[model samples]
Target: METASMSLLHALKEVLSEQQVTENQTVRELHGRDESYHKESLPDLVVFPETAQQVSEIVKLANKYEVPIVPFGLGSSLEGHVIPYEHGITIDFSLMNKILEVRESDFLVRVQPGVTRTQLNKELKKYGLFFSVDPGADATLGGMAATNASGTTSVKYGVMRDQVRDLEVVLADGSIIHTGNLAAKSSSGYHLNGLFVGSEGTLGCFTELTLNVYGIPEHVMAARASFPSLNDAVEAVVSILQAGVPIARVELVDEPSMKQVNLFSETSYKERPTLFLEFHGNEAGLKQDVEFTREIVEDHHCLDIEFETDNAARNRLWEARHNLAYAFIHGHPGKKMMVTDVCLPISELSGAISHAREAVDLLGLPGGIVGHVGDGNYHTLLMIDMSNQDEIEKAEKFNEQIVLYALERGGTCTGEHGVGVGKQKYQQKEHGQALHVMENIKLALDPDNLFNPNKILKTKDRG
Candidate 1:
């Protein structure tokens, strides 16, 4: 190791145990990249801090040495959120995985940052409760909060921001602060929870989180509706929402994605534009809602609708939707996946998606569209050989076109996928003067740009 790297390692080892710190090439390489197709840049060292105090001490040491600190969770992020591009210290939170307390009465849970969604849900199952933010990946709760992630259930349950009741975050200078409280609502000072939830670690590192959970519905039903065209499926969703159908989850999978799912999951779903729908409530109420939804979809020329009430069948239906991204990755052996996420107003969603499909076809790329369309968010999954400059350029153009369409219609470049390095360029265009306010917040919280530098916002220098 170089002198500077050795010095930093020694300092980290002093704060954490030798077992908690590593300079192994394999470990560094794993920490250097995320699920995104973005290029990787390895960190100098990786540390597994097991407590908030340990995280705070490590941050203090990094500040003392004038080095960057990137907080890492499961590294399942799709926008380079966990990649330590600055080659400094990457704090891996895996060791801190623990569900500390379950406030069953209050419908809340306190957990360490490394607690994954699957792990937490398994525990919540025993309490007849569940965490609603299911971002497809079994991402850590801390990482989900960092990205303000939302998924299928968000249509009814709201996003991660809504689920987060409190966050125990370690600031850039090693100070610990709670952004919220257990109270359901409060006229509190400066809604820090809102500010930090989607800050994407550009603000601080989360150590512990207190989140609101929900009781599992008394009755749950899952259904699949196939439409003749993508436009018809999306329009059905819009009408369902307009009529107040109270959908628990509604996801759109284009024909191409449906084929990928059938191939990967070993199922014989009809290869067509499909809407995976879910309902939650009493059986009688859900039946009424389901009937209304069926009528609405039928009006939009839905070819066929199938309902699944059995646990096994419901799991299989959602699993197919959740595994769509991985299926695309599996289909393209030597290519990396680049997913474009943009959300528009409900009335404009059909047009936005239509434009996106046209752009993908024009670019002549192997891509498919899928989304949690109940909330006007969608993604075009593209597989590209990074070495092929022409393909990469075309993919970039396709993403730009989709983002531009959304922005022009008062939509966001990214709805759930937080602005890591990927969506930074659209910040100024989307937020306008508000981007300056965000920059000021970053400067005030992390003046030295030590936390996840070059993410979310651009800085002239690391210093």
Candidate 2:
């Protein structure tokens, strides 16, 4: 270890218990990389703090010693959001996993930052309540909040920012403050909740979160509709939204992705442009909605449609969709995955997706396009042999093409993935002068740039 890192480690050992601080090579290596294809950089030390007070103390020590601190959850972020690029202290929140409280009447739940979305939903299910945001992986609520993650259900319910009612954050200066209260809406000082939720750990660390929840609908229906072409599938989704169908979840999985799902999930779902959909409402209302959705899709060249009301069938259908990424990884041996996503306005989604397919064909890359089409957000899953520099560069160039297309058509570089190292380069192009304002905010809150340095905004030139 470096001399400075050793000094910081000694100071941290004094503040936290010996067991809480470690320079173990295995642990550091594990905390070094996330789910992205980014190169790994191990931290000098990994610390597990159980309380908000301990987090504050760690932040103070990091600030005092001029060391960077990166907060880590399950390391499932796709954009290298949790990688310790600066090689400082990595705060893993695994030991702090706990669901603190549940207010059934108010539809609110207080949880520690380490609590995973699946874990929270399992508990909420007992009370007939559930959390909305389901980001493929069973990501920690804190990590989800950090990225403002959303998925298929975001079409109807909302994203992570909408669900978060309050957060107990530990600032860079070792000060602990609550960003919001339990109320539904407020005309308070500043919208700190919005600012902190998607800051990507560049602003502060989330120790606790109070989030909104929803009751399970009285009746639910799941369906899969196959279309002849990608354009038809996306156009069908646009029409569904325009026609005012209350869709709980609407996901698009292309033919290539469907093949992977079939191979991995041991099911024979037709390998075609398919839309996995769900409706949440009373039985009578859902029937009408499903019938209406079927009619709209058929008009757009839909090949076939299948509906499932049984729990087993619905679970299996969604499971295949959720596990699509893993299926890709399983199919391609000895390759790293690079998943890039962008969001466009619903009106422009058809052209954006059509452009994406053309790019993939032109590049001659083995990739698949899938998305939560209800909200105009989509992802391209690309696998590459990391040893080949040419492949890496080509994949990056392809990603840039897709992002530039989104930005040109009034979209964002990332729909759900936060601006970690991957999307930092496009910030200026997408946000223009507003990028400067974000940098200023980072400077104001973390003047020393001690929190997750070199992420979202680059303070120094890269080689």
> Candidate 1's residue-wise lDDT over 1-463, tens digit each?
8887788789888889989999899999999999998989999889999999999999999998888989999999989988887889999999999999999999999999999999999999999999999999999998999999999899999999999899999998899999999999999689999989998889999999999999999999999999999999999999999999999999999998999999999999999999999999998999999999999999999999999999999999999889899999999999999999999999999998888888888888899999889999999999999999999999998898889989999999999998999999999999999989988989999999999998999974875
Tens digit per residue, CA lDDT, model 2, 1-463: 7787788888998889999999999999999999999989899899999999999999999888888899999999988888988888999999889999999999999999999999999999999999999988999999999999999899999999999999999998999999999999999799999999999998899999999999999999999999999999999999999999999999999999999999999999999999999999998999999999999999999999999999999999999999999999999999898998899999989898889888887776678999999999999999899998988999999999999999999999999988999999999999999999988998899888888999999975322
TM-score of each: 0.99, 0.98
Worst 10 residues of 2 by lDDT: 454-463
Residue pairs whose backbone atoms clash in candidate 2: none
Q: Model 1: how large is the Cα RMSD against the reference?
A: 0.9
Residue 333 deviation, candidate 1, in Å?
A: 1.1
Q: Could you give the C-alpha RMSD of every candidate to the true structure, in order shown?
A: 0.9, 1.4
**Best by the TM-score measure:** 1
